[model samples]
Target: MARDEGGATDSPAAAYVFRVTVRIDPEVEGVWTEPDTFETTVVRAADSPGDPGWLYFRDNLWRGECGDEAHMRAVAEDALGMPVDAIDFRELRTTQAYLDDLRAAMADDLVEFNAETVDAALSKYLGSSIHVTDDI
Candidate 1:
């Protein structure tokens, strides 16, 4: 006989089910930090003791001296030790993003960036020295 789809049944063979969704922006850089990237993931679950389907999404963003996409890809690959395709750069844009991925880096007491060091990196692309005077 077919089972009823109404209220929960006390049948021993029956099982509960559920679903889940997760959006992750794998912050590649510090929050409000230049040249940042991210990736998102979604998943579904069921308590019926059976496997559930999985979904994944990815996005990479960046700002300031927009590095070559190829170079960025290589950096990501080396850092993650994964395939190049896995690094999704679809959402990458030269703009500031409102994310808190850099909290650790900023809060860390050991991490320090002086004006000279910052200028050198910027000078490589900006053709001139720059200072990290901005709070962002």
Candidate 2:
């Protein structure tokens, strides 16, 4: 987890909640029994709001965890309207950053009207579709 110049969390430092839908590989029956969900945190420099810590998984493995990163990325990309490479992963506070971003993005005037709409709007403005999820 990278620290900001102020020796604290950065501007985009927030928790982003993502509903990951794991698609089990047909080759491996019940390889993952259920859809394990989790969140990732991202910290960005207050000055450099666009460059935030991103999260990524390789070979379907995590940081010694059960949840998959690819699933999370897919969901996020769908919501954010951007590529997976756009999101940075932070080690110090992944969950916290994710939640913070989620709250900030959703905490808008239209949140009460529809959560999906807010998400879509955020994705469009933020230029990241990785936060969106399918209607599963």
Candidate 3:
């Protein structure tokens, strides 16, 4: 990692948390295999620049939290190896430097995201859910 005059490293760092709730539908599968709705965590490591992480807004996000719960459920199932019925987005805890990199990356491809600006793209997907944290 390269450092500037102030000795601040340029590498971007961030972390994301997705809170998931799931249960087998008692009506569909019968009560034989059933567990009440419960919360769990699904880990999706932040992808590199070329991955275009912002696409969730253009293609997935429904309101501002999670647009495609099914997709999230699939992700959790893959991670936990269990059937998941629901997924919820809590917040993206990140460092300011990481956000700057995200903004820069988004600015490079506005049309692909169907966003007039980077902030718009971020807001559409993340909403007011970003929490800038000092701790990585």
| lDDT of each residue in 1-136, candidate 1, tens digit only | 2357785433322111111121233456654523333343211111121212110101112232223556654655564544343332222111122112122222332223222343332233333212222121
TM-score of each: 0.21, 0.21, 0.70
> Order of all candidates by TM-score, from best down to worst?
3, 2, 1
List lDDT for all candidates, in order: 0.28, 0.38, 0.69
**Per-residue alpha-carbon lDDT of candidate 2 for residues 45-109, written as tens digits (9 for 90 to 100):** 22211233222221222332324556656755666544443233332223445535544634544
- RMSD for each model, in Å, please? 20.3, 14.1, 7.6
Clashes of 3: 2
Model 3, runs deviating above 4 Å: 1-12, 22-37, 51-59
lDDT of each residue in 1-136, candidate 3, tens digit only: 4699999866436655688776644556435553566778764545555575644434655445777777877877888766677788777777887788778888998886778998888887788877787764
Error of 3 at 106 (Å): 0.7
Relative to the true structure, candidate 2 reaches a TM of 0.21
lDDT: which candidate is best? 3
**Ordered list by lDDT, greatest first:** 3, 2, 1
Which sections of candidate 2 miss by over 4 Å? 2-12, 26-136
Candidates 1 and 2, the one with greater TM-score: 2
Residue-level error in angstroms, candidate 2, position 47: 10
